[model samples]
Target chain A: MGFRSLKTKLLLAASLLVISSGVALSLLVSDQYSKSLIDSARHQAENLALSLAIESADKVLTHDLVALQKSLDHQMKSNRSLAYLFVVRDGQVLAHTFQKNFPQELLDANTVISEDGGNEQTIVSTTGERFIDIARPIFQGKAGLLRLGISEKSLERQVDELRMKMGLITLFILLTAIAGSLFLVKRITGPLGELARSVENIKQGSWDVKIRVSGRDEVTILAKSLINMAARLKHYTQRLENQKLELERAHNQTRIFCEIVRELGTV
Target chain B: MLFSITSIKPIAIFRVSLIIITALSNIGCSDHEQSKVVNFSNTITLEKPDTKQRGDKQLRVAIGAMVSPRESISIYQELLDYLGEKLGKEIVLEQRKTYSEINELLGKSEVDFAFVCSGPYVVGKEKYGLELLAAPEVNGSHFYNAYLIVNKDSRFNTIEDLRSKTFALTDPDSNTGKLAPIGWLKKIGEKPETFFGSLIYTYSHDNSILAVSRGFVDGASVDGLIWAYFNKTNPDLTSNTRVILKSENYGTPPVVATRQMSKSMKEAIKRALLGMRDDKRGAEILDRLMINRFVPAKDDWYNSIRDVIESAGVSMEPQDGLSKSEN
Candidate 1:
């Protein structure tokens, strides 16, 4: 049964596989890298908050809240990326450094800061930008919480740069894959296209047409086999025609002989 | 050809699967290897109490102010190597941006040692149990002063004239800029935020000096060490600036270790520093740092700074008491 060519289907399948796999890999790597960056940034922010808290520990213990606030604010301002800083005492925000409002959940005295050693959550700001909130307990007892946040803009920018690079690499890989598949398909099918045209020539009475075999592949073997089959069929048909002509000649002679015998007998 | 199509499908699928598996496996292996390398390099060092007995563990050291790779590559690498050799263990330097940051690192035991300014040390001493290790002597002096400066062309001649004028102070934990000025202001019965049109924290002595010199602010309080360094190196910064007042001498910034540090290790570090000025190579390094000597110091030396910090009207609580949220 005739069907769509195998070479064409294979090429299509291969191209799809390459492109899809490239996309999948790009996505996986992007996700992993982004996660790692966010995690490292959160860790850094937590360490920073811890340091600020320790530096102001005396003030916090002595109830010198003003000194603690000034020290924290001074630190947050030094690094422009830091957005908010707050120290919670007994479930209330004892001091905050940013003008923006903070989440009340962060101020709960009973809510233990997650020191789980990694980024816990990402919050979106009113502007729709994301930030990584890093919280650390200032003192194990008495003093409540010290939460620090840094806008993810910088980290996002870094991830975006990585994504762009990976995107370029993926694009290059996809293009190369397509180009390679096309070249390979053309190489395999070029001979078959030639074979089909040759068969058409034979159908149109070009008896001298012969198929050429160049390589030791299945297509080459098939081409060679088809050429042999076509040659044998042509030879067999010519022999059959010659045998019919010979039999007809013999029959005509016999008829003449019979007619001559009948005339002689009548005389 | 039609049969070949059926056969080629399975082959192609098999080859594609193999390629994908290989690619994924390679990627996974590389990721694993990279993580291993990162973990190996990031291992913290823990120091042993006995000085003569070499500890197989590592000691983690934290430093304030992030040092650029290009600027600190040689110095820090050498410092780590030197400390590792002396302690017979690995030494890591963790850089933070502020004195408070270093103090917190010490308090959390994330770092075993640090070099901190007087203000943060005073605050940390009361809170984190910080102990002094050594003090750097610059130009044969163990003391430095705070200079209150104003534009040479400005009308202000004395600290009193700064009323209703703009003022810039370095970090709140700065002994020279914030502490001394706070003490001076309180003695004169003036409040910084209320008396001045506005107050800003520059966070660095260099920035504070530049702000006043550029006339961005009417005046600024800066560290004398930074002022002298800039005057000798880059005269342009000092050319347009004049010192309006100077604070009394105070102990210079000290090299401090955490209270968790063993007495033996602390003594070793102290001995290393005090003798640093005497060692040929150590002396050269000290010279390059513009420090004339390494002197023995105690926590008491920073009491004056503690007094200033206590009097600074600024709250140590985390709150909105400072200038309106920073831009």
Candidate 2:
């Protein structure tokens, strides 16, 4: 394939630069915002879990599973961000709000805590949906875990908004850059185009044609050099023309003299 | 040939430099986005621990009144200077016209200390780690009431009589002005939008009170402390105003410090305030402020305020908290 024009190359470069930077900025802002949102959500989830754990502490101490289920439901309904709540005891699921099974990774025995509350962990399903799960340990006769599951939709929404804003800004930058590049290339190359036309005229024997050097750029310098060269060639050609005329005049005179000498000598 | 060579140097230099710059810029462009992402994330992590500690030295403090109000600014400046002298540091007091501005400042940790109404302190404590240092004693008690005021000539006698009339809320985040009225409305199975013909946030208790007295709004809720202050100092505003309803007593506005402050500094600040009402020099400033005393306080004084926030269905989570930390 033929190489692209310099203008095309420069424009492509500018566009790539703008897009990459914009994408990076968007990703950065989104990531920061997402992490903060997640942390906030985690803290909120922890607080919710603490409240739920405290509210059901008496029932949990008595090992009343039924009352625990009702309290979890009540708490989940009160918070719109909450997706599900599950109570686990002795590495077995005692109750869960959703019919879908909890991920085994989150239910790992080592992941479960028996004291000092617990930490939140994120899980992504095979379909690429994300969730933040906060697990708090309920200690009574037996160690139980109270887990609050919150959807990542809110964070995702925020990230999407940032991405959209960045995308628009990138598009604006790319368009301006491409337009500017084209305008600059045309402006700088205009003198070169004029120089080419003047050279063509010189080849057609129009040596007297004057070339103008209007700019301080390289193209103007090239025009000035070409004009000087044309002037020198014209000077040298004029000298050669004078020498030819002188030789012709001398030949004519010599012919006349030869005829006169021949006639006088014959007489 | 020598002339040509000399003439060509500048062109060659110019062309080479342009090519170099364009190439370098293009190369840099490719990685620019990724670097921004990396940098922002790094900043979040690096700055998290220092977020609370960053502006500690400057001592950003806000007063809950218009900065242009001569009386409010004078009282606030007096308090700040007094505190500054006790702490042996220069104090910068920020003035916010609305309760929301004070809340936002406190929430962002932009202000280290604030003299905010009981309502904003309650809402901010749960979201941002706000600790009560002292409560202002006026009229011999550390408590204030919210008065529902109407024009003196208005026929409205009770809260129910003001239905379908325009009402002015001091601020959306205000406790006594917005939350308390909403609570009363809720008890009667009505909402602000359903009960009032129109509602607007005046952004200040003084402005809301003025709006009610001027007949721009049919009624408004104001702090009794402010009403008393105007009654004693600027009676012209109160000449056309009369209280029609009153809310139960709630703790008065308090001086609050961020939870991030050091124990020693917190103690020094509390000592400075508690002694202010007793010291002859400090008492002079407090007397001009119409403050009777300053008493030691705790976090529990704001429980009623928390109850109002909880009842209002406002969530306390910082929208950017987790995402910023992760980045």
The complex in candidate 2 yields a DockQ of: 0.02
lDDT of 1 at B75: 39
Worst 10 residues of 2 chain B by lDDT: B34-43
Q: Write the per-residue lDDT of candidate 2 for residues B52-154, one digit (tens) a residue.
A: 3434456667776521233455446677888898888767655554566677777776777788778778877766868888998898988778889999999
Candidate 2, CAPRI quality class derived from DockQ: incorrect
Candidate models: Cα lDDT each: 0.69, 0.69
Q: Estimate each model's TM-score.
A: 0.45, 0.43
Model 2: per-residue lDDT, tens digit, A1-267? 122444444545555656656655666666677677877988898888877766654444333457667877777778889977877654556666754444454454224444775766765555566677777876431336777778888778987887788779878877887788778877765566677777898898878756666867777788888889888888888888899899999999999999999999999
Error of 2 at B264 (Å): 1.7
DockQ of each: 0.05, 0.02
lDDT (Cα, 0-100) at B224 in candidate 2: 82
Cα displacement (angstroms), candidate 1, residue B6, comes to 54
